[model samples]
Target: MGTATPHGARAHARAQHGTRTPTMPVVPATDWPAPPAGAGPLVWAETVAGGGYAHKVLARGTELRLTDLHGDACAHLVLLAAGRPWERFNAADTVKVQWNAYLRAGHLLLSAQGRVLATLVADTTDGRHDTLCGTSTLVLNTERYGDGATHCATPAGRELLTLAALKNGLDTRDLPPSVSFFQGVHVDANDGTLHFTGSAGPGGSVTLRAEQDLVVLLANVPHPLDPRPSYTSTALEVLAWRAEPTRPGDPLWDATPEGRRAFLNTAELLTCRGQS
Candidate 1:
């Protein structure tokens, strides 16, 4: 199926409310089990250099971690089912159907096929992120930041994802839409323009738990609306480990009425493939 809306638009019409701090009661986060303490051994890890990109395949029970090593990092992440790239993430459906504009912990990033790709199972930053105002584009960056500014557009992320999927014999055209982590953006209530309100501090982090085998692509770049004088983008640390299976009363599956239904859809999809 085609995208319900261009991810480039980042759902321009959607209004959002987010938190500057996790302490804000208005942006409550779900309870996640305490991660095993210490910087233990990881299955795989890398530091994505500023302006660089990377991609990987995360199994259904793998955890992907993004860390803001320099206190100011933006990671544009795109995801698609490893076995079905056409069934990619749908930002509009994720926002409208799930009744949420801002995503934090306990939220499922839904796909156009009504399947859950991953769950925002953990966030230790400001508890805010954007599925709207996708990564900067070549045309956009050149227009605003001048020539060569096109260096870090979101497609850079697609390129990485394509590279990662190459082992699977997939190409760039198979890449899909993405969500920006650490980009705490919000829509102006009165004017409806997107605002880059800033993001995570040093050591801050967010985690995505794969709901199915996923082709993950990412880049460390400036948010489209970032006001920093320079690109200011820096290296980001990507870490992975096995994720525990969800059980009865799991918060993400039970976060909302839509979440439950989405989880069911994910289960049915997996079951049909005999993965369940």
Candidate 2:
């Protein structure tokens, strides 16, 4: 008698034979844990496997959080205004405007127009995030690993982001400089060199609140600065829910003079564009 086939093998056989299998939604089942007490209604939830990517156009005020499950995922991020793709996240502006290279709970992600795109509402990584080192490229990963094509075992973060961009009506030229979370780097004060610090272990997370109707692209792949010889990364959990946008009197908006200016500029643009 023939041995029993594994369930996944059976499913693959059916798919190869043209048995229609529709793509599944990102929502979780009823048994999943509910959102925090005042987080508003849950809007999206999904787990991105290593070397994978996710993208969505979220409305203003939605709070999105990324969790480093199993302690090894590097989440590369790119933000763009939903309708105006050219106005996108400016990493240099973000660091220079704030006068800080390390980002945390209160820093605002800004665009070149001086508009606030999102606010870092929570950070549990103890400063394990990066603005200097961007995601991995095909050539870099190809040199490190044997193969770096999208179809290979270890795909480059740039390839993943390119695919995600295409799905959102964008191309390589529209892709902007990205910020990374979970893994980080620090400048050596003595020599002014850079050093890589791996993740902050499991269950660490960072949350951001959207300040505009934004396009968020994320790729979970090994950090380009990672010292590991073999390509490796773990899973990442993403959850977004409805929340209120920042108001003039919000503490975060008034945290600093420069930050307030950015917020005011954001509000001015929103009002002129007929958004409340």
Which candidate number has the best TM-score? Answer: 2
lDDT of 1 by residue, 49-164 (tens): 66677677778878788888877678888788887889777888988887877987887888988888888878998765788877766665566655333243333344444455
**Candidate 2 segments exceeding 4 Å error:** 1-25, 28-34
How accurate locally, in lDDT, is each candidate? 0.71, 0.88
- RMSD, one per candidate, in order: 14.4, 4.5
**TM-score versus the correct structure, for each prediction:** 0.78, 0.90
Give the per-residue lDDT of model 2 (tens digit) for 235-258.
Answer: 888889889889988999999999
Give the TM-score comparing model 2 with the true structure, all chains together: 0.90
With candidate 2 superimposed using the best TM-score fit, by how many Å does residue 40's alpha carbon deviate from the native?
A: 1.6
Clashing pairs in 2: none
Query: Over all chains combined, what TM-score does candidate 1 have?
Result: 0.78
